[model samples]
Target: MPAPYQPAGVSVGDVPGVAQTAPRPPLREDLNGLRGVAIALVVVFHVWMGRVSGGVDVFLVLTGFFFTASLIRTAQSGGSLNPFTRIGRVLRRLGPPLVLVLVGVAVATALLLPRTRWVDIANQVVSGVFFYANWELAWTSQDYLAADPSVSPLQHLWSVAVQFQFYLVAIVVVFGLAGVLRRSRGVHRASPPPHVYLVLFAGASLVSFVYAADGTSRLQSWNYYDTGARLWEILLGGAVAALFAARHPRPTHERRSSEFRTGRTALAVLGLAAVVACGFLLDGVNEFPGPWALFPVLATIALIAAGPDTSVGHLLRSRFGLWLGSIAFPLYLWHWPLLIFTLAYSGKPSADLATGAAIIAASVVLAMATVRLVEKPLQAPGGSIPRIAITATAAVLAAALVCGSAGWNFYIQRSVSDLQASDELDPFTYPGARELTDGATAPDADVVPALFSAPEDLPVTSVEGCIADFETRDAISCEYGDLSASRTIALAGSSHAEHWVTALDMLGRDRGFRVVTFLKMGCPLTLGTMPMLGESEYPDCLDWTQTVMSEVEQLGPDYVFTTSTRPREGGQGDYTPDFYVNVWNELTSYGIPILAMRDTPWLVKDGVVYRAIDCLADGGSAMSCGMPRGAALDPINPTLASSFRLPTVRPLDLTSALCDGPICPAVVGNVLVYRDEHHLTATYVRTLTSELGREIAASTGWW
Candidate 1:
């Protein structure tokens, strides 16, 4: 559907003639049709193709163009430029449908989603109501625990938030100019001159453009939803509006000259081509809201400048296009959640073409129902400030009630779990290492402790703030095991390596060796650049790695422990990349014995990472939540092959303890094996202390 700020029933043909220097241009049917096309691209790309359609960029431009133009016209015509009236009109138009969707999603989540996901859904619902969902996603993007494939139903609201923010900014700019004109000693006008507005728009656009370019390069995932980074596109629309306002007044009875029509037609054709081509050619996720975004922004401007007189405009203004535009906003809202909920229930990474078509059909029906029943009635001509305010307040309160209930339930569950946990359980009943090595059957799944079922049930390292996050550049070292031990074993690498620290710490404390951790989130001790979220190079990780290695060399630890291999695509077994070999060689040069542990099996099915806890919460059995042993690991550890040629680099594989003969269970010895997809839970890792100690002693003779 059209942008949240797009005025209902107000087309180019309906705008009243302004008594300014230039006659105001009528709203074009073609622009509305363009909005229809943009939303179509977005839905199709998000649902069937799993790509961004660049349609949101087009919508941003249109929102800026339409809203700014209307405001400028109002100011020039000596009409009231009251922010409250304009903002209220926008709120009345957008709020009802958005609230409807939010409430619908809340009900769907309760019925379809597992209880474990309720907290997140509730948080997103609250954010969506307040128009800060983008910032919420931005903060969550940095959290490693929160990173999952289960897309939030409210994720698409980020664009709506950006548009809402822009509306506020537009109101301020327009009214601020009007107030300035009134205060001036000599200049007495309803609005500032067109040039003044143009200068301001240009300056703001330039600043925002630079920030977007730089921010996208550095922290794209966070910047992607940032309103500040998105202002340039809106300002470009404002600039277009200013230029339209500055046009020379045309005679009321005169038609456009032939030359003007010819130029407009040429522009319309090129503009249409550019808009269509952008969806196909550009990679929206990787290169957008930056300098590369200029292509779509410019094309949209050309189309706006072209007006609705040409053949291309005629096509855009067709009945089909107008209908699509009419339902565009609600369609955009309904489609994503429908797609995501369908995927979750179907237990598929993505929907097939037929399934996708059914989803789109369902979305269209819902959108039409919402537009007819909710959006149209509230946005009718009699909408007043008090009415709109009361409705908005009711919507917010309803959303708050849903979110509050979810949060309260989450707190209650966590409290009950905490109280139930006890240190008095029998060691044999909870036998971790003994059951695995002794071939004893594990306790019943129902009898197993509910550890690792929630985010609060994290490993000691995470709970104690030992493991660093993405933004952390400085090395955070923590000591574990026997403090007075003469021999020191250094653990270094990413979170994969950090997961093994619990076992190592227990082993060291028992056998009298000091354990020092040098861990960075997502950063392994490899020479090559690591790929961060969105496939961008992590400069902080690379720089941090260099510093870490330098410190490790100076410390001259007797043994350095880290993960050595990663899983290959298509379940082809783990392999050590060249970077691992380079790091091994560097460590060996310092005469530091390298204990290269094999990485854990990531729980993945059909290329999507699945959390064991989520599967369990959804009533899946241990075997059902687990992958085949062969699918996750090679028969022989890949690190073993690399270690064969290097005397100091010894490979350690505990797959035998973590997995059975053919199958890898989610839980071993009544303990949940993984905290999320790959990281081993501290409870499970502690159970491996005995086995781990035996292996390290055999390899290093430290004990």
Candidate 2:
């Protein structure tokens, strides 16, 4: 968990802003208690509801508030800001528990996770150690093929990265502004005027807010992890702190007035209520860092402004709250990985209520132990900056070593797999798709080479710029098979439709028909806009579909092949979506026949998608890893129903070749069936060449 801002205390007495002549305010135990409450909400919401709590937003505000106040106070007291000293303090507070947790998670992953997942976990460990997990996730989110039910244990570290980034930015801004003020005045005043800081905060917040709001609407997945989009929440806290500093404290007589007390009490109560309500009322994961984040941020600001002696404040400062707050950082660090590992081990996407409670209980115990045994000793008083720097450097080196070893091992495994694939093994034992439909027994699934290919082993057509990604709009044409052949077959659609190109390319070479591909990563040939993972409209896909349709029409291919059916939500079997129907109707009007291939079974079970390599590496045999035929597919092809009404549309389904009587095996004829959750592997598809060619010849009468 990202650490909450430490309240002002004797530890920071040397900072420039404190007035040596006047007694400083006592450390705010109530704010610490607030941090405890925030962590509680975060853990419970994550474990039981699988949603984000607005707790992180509150912490971001508190972090900005305390950090800004310290800097402003230092500037006011005529002390120059020391970036190294400040950053060292922050590292001492955050680094120990984070490193401990990373090492612990790495050990846990090695013990519990499958071999196939080791590389990903290692990558995450390195990224988290270096404070770049958010950037890594942003890149991963853009890949449509990377979606999986298995959650990374280090996913929570994205917030930690954001917090560290803010710390760096805040330090630079404070020092830079103070230097400018000194130069302009020619006389060193303690600090710049409060109004100057206020103006700067306002401008920064407005820009960040607008960027966040607009980006959320356009690309929420990218925005979710974006540091720029989240700056306003922290900046708002700085603005509040500036306002508080500008006003001198009231006289004792005025401060003790009954009216003042009543107003403060009332405001504190309302603010506390709002803070608690946010956790329950809003879906923080979906609504946040955007304008919707105001709920939690404002509630926190209200609580801070209400001061410490009110009823709500007293409750927050109670023994339980203070204790929770004390351990909040370590608790946050331990809980997420524990929860994710528990779910993975249990083979459940979400834990039941009892299991969730147990997980929370376990996390609390581990967090307490971690703080007492690891964090406290490292952050003990009199620790030198040089010592801390050495420790941090050592930790980074250790993480890099682990990551490097994992990458080397992964490369070796892939190299071996590639080498085996390139060699000609006995065709009888490694009999591709022939064993599935031709009564040949598949070799034992355990001993098969190339049983599971890495993501890089996808078809050349799928990887080599032939398949346009989400951001690409223009159609990229790639020719395969017999380029000189007079007859041409156009393959156009998403990766699902593109997977069959391996088989079609082989057929073209033998049958003298040129194969032209117009492939996009995840976009099907549809007139309607495709909805992306974050519920944002895929305008690029829509625009690209129009472009491809025109290109295909102009090429005037003998036959255009594309997927024609999609699985109905919360229903059995597949159906032709209206978008597919619209495209087919238009294509047939041009008198060019449409080859509507039935889409393959997606290996999703009980809402959790299973990856073939993960299943195989987790000791699952072909029979154990395969999905039930009835669960994955309808008994009859659904596209046949829609195609019968259209004269130029021909439905070609090869489900029998992919599935046996009751099971759709992950490995058919000793060849891995899927590259990921939904797309077929090139190796398996290539084996379907003979059957696919025969079907096309019969339908088009061109061979």
Q: In every candidate, how many clashes are there?
A: 5, 5
Compose the digit string of candidate 2's lDDT tens values, residues 501-612: 8888888888899999999877898886474534555667788889999998899998899998877667666777888888988888777889999988888777777777
Candidate 1 lDDT trough over 10 residues, lowest sum: 9-18
Candidate 1's displacement at residue 229, Å, is: 2.7
Clashing pairs in 2: 1-333, 16-74, 17-73, 17-74, 75-190
Candidate lDDT (C-alpha), each? 0.77, 0.77
- What TM-score does candidate 2 reach? 0.89
Name the regions of candidate 1 deviating beyond 4 angstroms: 1-24, 74-84, 142-149, 180-190, 247-259, 381-397, 400-426, 440-442, 445-452, 529-534
Residue lDDT tens for model 1, 1-703: 6433233422211232335554656657789999888888888888777877788888888888887887777766665666787777677667777877888888889888877677777877877777787888887773211112477888888888888888889889987788767667434445787777778887898999999998776677777788888889988888888887777756644437887788889998998888877868877776678888888888899999888889889999898888888888899889988988898888787778999899999999998897776665565445566556647665776667566757656785675467346423355767765576867665554434463254444555776899777767788888888878998989998888988877887778888888888888778887864646435657777777788899899988889999888888665677888888988988888889799898888888877777787788888876788878888888888887788899898888888888866877887777777767788876677778778887888899766
Error of 1 at 574 (Å): 0.9
For model 1, name the residue pairs that clash: 1-328, 1-329, 2-329, 12-26, 12-27
Q: Report the Cα lDDT for candidate 2.
A: 0.77
